[model samples]
Target: MNSVQKLGFSENAKLLIIHADDAGLSHSENMATIQSLEEGFVNSYSIMVPCPWFYEMAVYAKNNPKFDYGIHLTLTCEWENYKFGPVSPVSEVPSLVDENGYFYKKREQLRKSATPEDVKKELQAQVEKAIKFGLKPTHLDSHMYSVGSDAKFLKVYKEIGEKFDLPVLINKQLMQMVGLDPDINIKEGEFVIDNTYIGEFKYFEDGKLGDFYKGIIENLTSGINLILIHPAFDDSEMKGVTINHPNFGSQWRQIDFDFFTSEINKAKLKENNIELVTWGDLNKIRKGK
Candidate 1:
């Protein structure tokens, strides 16, 4: 039996947490995530509760409670045209929402004017909304790593996580769960990458996708490794929405999908016998299965 199955999870032997982020951002993302989960390519996913399509994804979760899912705490609406406002009222979270009634476009912008009280209220509202929709999220994480960058935000996030009895992804926890620290720099372009973090989550700038595959292969850890990736097909809709976004839009996300399913990645995982586990199984292990 594989590590996850040994721990009394589903008979599937591998223990992986292949998650698709921004589930409610667009139909393309939602469809891809569902397909990947059905195909056994992705084991878990997270939803952006503030986005337009959040209700659809929430309904899917309610119908399929067996699917390991979580909340991707959305503090900013990075994309234009397809923007989302705060889950709480504008009066309550005015610091997080912009003048146009949408959330801030970037972390730095939010940090400049945001307060801890507003963040706490907004986060609680998100959780309440999810529960109201009959969704019991498996875990919690920031949409754009907003909680991790600021100490005040991190404190609120951790408190909310504990209150909900959910695990919040932390570099300290990740390092402790996994064996070693990665060698590369963890920060890139307003995004913070955690080294205890396995996987190449950074945007590929002038580098081949092979390098990312190699990075994951070379850095496989003994315990649970949670790698985050945004997978989407490069279509006109996604392009139009995300084009000119500094984060490389669908190009980087498509490359992430390719790297995740690449031959080199398969070979490395098979060679190392690394298990792909979901957060559910990982939590079980943490709780001393």
Candidate 2:
């Protein structure tokens, strides 16, 4: 039986996970994520353990044990002014960081300077730290999909997820986005979502990001699907954090928050017969629960 079958869904079931990425990046992000999860179609989210507002989200996650959250393994600090680093001491995972000790700004920088051992070490440290903070993370994923930048890093990602008995976001589109051959990178028997969607830059630029999302729900197909989003307020704080970056910047995140939280999108999901699933629901497959 396939994973969908394992989940007790029919062979033709249309499973969709509307996942909010970057949950703990800032107070604005954390608050937006909580609001989306509680009152919107965003059923799952992930935490950036090294971020400044991690404690805020961690407390909320621990208190609300029923919500689905995951560890977003982070190795790159993408913002111009905002930066974060490894949960492991910089001295031990020095290769993963820049000369100033913050994580590198891009995936290519991480792939060039980081060792597989250091990548694995820091990512595992992030998971451990989340656990120590009383978070019951349902799965694991990556920030910027950095794990796909290197084949060795991909292996390390799968290994860490297996070590903790959690699902890691693995899909052909995600690997191909980072220029990896999914056929070569993915092994047999691994859980791979069939489809994943993220708003294209052109769509975001054209002010049709909401249209793109509505179309996804309207035309969603069978098998496991995921729509990755970054939900945050478009306030001055987010504008500062994402200054000079207009692609997934503050306004972009605000659109994501608006679309996902709106009742229209919720109606679209039901109208198209899309079954919303969470990482915690997938986690049960590992335990035969």
Candidate 3:
């Protein structure tokens, strides 16, 4: 059966997952995630286990068990000044890190050096670490979709989900965005979210990101859809982390926080007859399976 039918909706139901990515990147990120989830349209989010702010977020997740959260299996640290590394010891996942013992800044750099074994080890370690901290993660997804950089790493991503028995964020478009051949990499009958949306750099540059998102709600299609956003304040901490990176920089994230949390955005979904779902809801389906 299709996702809509599985969710007990009509076949033509427009199910949407407004997911906030990067919850544990910083204090600003954690605070924004909390507010967005508690008071905004964001229903799902994932945590970056290797980031310095992970424990703070984890504490909140532990206190509030009803919220939907997943592990953002991170491999590359994209920030300029602030950075993080593997959860496993550097000695164990040496190939996954640079000389500074932190994750590489780009996926291409990680793909060039990361061995499949090390990738599996680090990703699995991230999952285990989350569980160890008493935060029950509902699903798994990749940070920057880094697992799709190589086919072997993609396989590792799937295997880790199976090992942990959690659903993964699998989509052909995400794989193709990372230069993986989706037809060859994704198997037949596998669950894939083909209609995933994220704000483009052009939208941020043109100051039309809110319009871009509004259009998405207006034109949403049948089956499952996803909109990945990063909610953070444009503060000194975020500015320091995103220095020289204006694409998903501090101000851009602030726009994301404001737009997703607006009552008008929530009303637009209801008026358009769109149904919002969560990774936690999806986890119940996986567990039942």
Candidate 4:
């Protein structure tokens, strides 16, 4: 059965998850994501535990228990200047870090240096820190797709998800991209989404981001579909943090924020009959509630 049916929705229901990524990466990101959650189209967000502003995001989650949030399990620090390291002791998880003491800035670097043991240790520390800070994450997902990029790391991610009884984000496209066998069967009762959409859309006309999103909403299939967005304000702080990275940089993130917050986009979802769901909803299904 499909994820919508498992969640008690009709098989034909077009379920969508408008999820914000990198909630704790910066003040701009936190502010934009929180605003989007409160007054925009973003129904869910995930925190980067190892980022510098994690405590701010954690406190917000603690105060707003009704908002759906999860952990964006971080492994690589992709920014050029701004970087973060493992929550585990640097001495213990040395392989997870680079010579400069921050995490490697690329997935290729992480794949070369990190072992499964180090990955598990760092991931466990991230989860423990979230629990310690009074933030109960609804699910687990990878940062820069690192955890899902290798079968060994994917095993560790699944183990952690099962241990915490939280649903981990998994899909066939990611499995195939990482050279894993996409035909492996998901366990019964486990929640697995049918598709996940990330990165920028290619069909650009008049340079309007909302047009791209409208196309996506209109074409959404009948199943659980996850759309990952990184929303932030285009401010000096965001600009400084995003430096030379123009793809998902401050301007790009602001475009995402504006597109998701637009009234037209909200209407489009309704017009397309897309049922917005949250990670918390999926977690309930995983818990058999």
Candidate 5:
């Protein structure tokens, strides 16, 4: 049988994977994630373990263990003022860090400079930190698809996932067409929502964000559908934090908030009989297997 069949997901029912990215970035991100979780617009979220406010989010997770969360394994510090130092000491994984002691500025720089051994060491350090902080993560994924893009990195990441017995996201198309192997050795879950399913979510756009409700009209398939969103307030905090980011993750995140909470989108889903789900379900299914 194929990967999806191995995971035990029903082939007929459409599964929705609404995951919120960037959970431990700032207060804006934290508040947004909580609101989205309560609102039922987002099913899963990942935390940047190396972020400055990581412990705070970890505490929240410990208290409210019901939320489905994963580690957004961070290898690079993309922001300027907002940056995190390496979890592994400089002496241990010197290549993963810069002269100033933080991680490299970009993925390309890290990919070029870091050795496979150094990458593995840093990943272990980050995961250890999360466990130290009392986070029983539901799954594993990269912050910027760092593991998925590089073969060596992917190997280390998958090793960790298998060691921990956690479920990870690996696009089937990438596996076939791009030759991106799974970071872990486990069989693919029964449920599968390929990227093509997510590519169809045009729920929210600029200006007329209200018009996105029309998207729910399309009949959804029975398989899983993962909808990725980055939601945050365009407050002074997010603005100041993401000043140099041209893609404006903070600003674009605010746009996600608009789209997710829009009544049009909610009504459309209700009208189309779409059911939302969380990664917690996937974790349970994988754990049962």
Candidate 6:
């Protein structure tokens, strides 16, 4: 059965998951993500376990156990100045790190060097650390799409998700985007969204974010849809953290925050009859399976 039916929704129901990514990269990111989850249309977020602000996110998750948060299983630290390495010992997962002893700054670098054993070790360590800090993570997803970039990495990612009984973010569309076979068999009972949208900020050149999102919401199909957004305050902190990167930088994130939080966006959801579901809700389906 498809996700909508499996979740007990009508066949034509438009299910949407507005998930904020990079929740623990910096103070600005943490603050914006918390606000977006608590006060805005964003229903879910994932914590970057290897980032500097991970402890802050962990404490928040511990205190607010009801929020739908997950581990953004991190392998590559893509910032210029800001960087992090494996939660496991460097000696143990040596192939997962660069010469500087930090995670490689790009997915291409990681894909060339990281071994499956190292990936599994580091991923397990990240999940274990989150659980140790009192976070019952709702799901798992990759940072920089690293884990899903290769078949071997994906194998370890799937294994870890199965081990934890948490949903790993995977979709046929995304698989195809990375030159993987879209028809790759997923284990029975594993939750997979039918479609996932990661906003392309290049389309937001001339105050077009509202239109871009509205178009996406309107075009959403029957099955579950996950929209990945990075919501952060456009402050000095965020600016500094995302110094050279304009793709998902401070201003870009603020636009996401603004659009997702706007009353018009809420109205659009109601107008389109889109049912916002959380990763926690998806977990219920996993449990039943």
Q: 185-227, model 2: which lDDT tens digit per residue?
A: 8888787889999988999999999999999999988888999
Q: Which of the two candidates, 1 or 4, achieves a greater lDDT against the reference?
A: 4
Would you list the C-alpha lDDT of every candidate in the order shown?
0.69, 0.92, 0.91, 0.85, 0.69, 0.86
Error of model 4, residue 211, in angstroms: 2.5
Stretch of 10 with least lDDT, candidate 5:
196-205
Backbone clash tally (model 1): 4
Among all windows of 10 consecutive residues in model 4, the one with the lowest summed lDDT is 199-208
Model 6 pairs in collision = none
**TM values, all candidates:** 0.80, 0.98, 0.98, 0.94, 0.82, 0.95
Which lDDT value does model 6 have at 191? Answer: 66
Candidate 6 lDDT tens digits, 1-289: 6667778889899999999999899999999999888878999999999889999988998898878899999998877877788888899999989887999987778888989999999999999999988889989998877887678999899999989988899887677666678676455555678888876756666667667788889888887998889999999998888898887888889989998888878788888889999988888877875
Tens-digit lDDT string for candidate 3 (175-278)? 77889988899898666775899888999999999999999999999988999999999999999999999988999999999999999888999999999988
- Misplaced by over 4 Å in model 1 are 1-16, 172-203, 246-248, 261-268, 286-289
Off by over 4 Å in 3: 287-289
Which numbered prediction scores highest in lDDT against the true structure? 2
lDDT of 5 by residue, 87-206 (tens): 777898888888888887787778788888988888777878898888988888777666644677777887787777776666654343334543442244433345422211233224
Rank by TM-score (best first)? 2, 3, 6, 4, 5, 1
5 or 6: which has the higher TM-score?
6
For model 1 the local lDDT of residue 23 reads 87
Better of 1 and 2 by TM-score: 2
Q: List the residue pairs that clash in candidate 1.
A: 15-276, 15-277, 16-276, 16-277
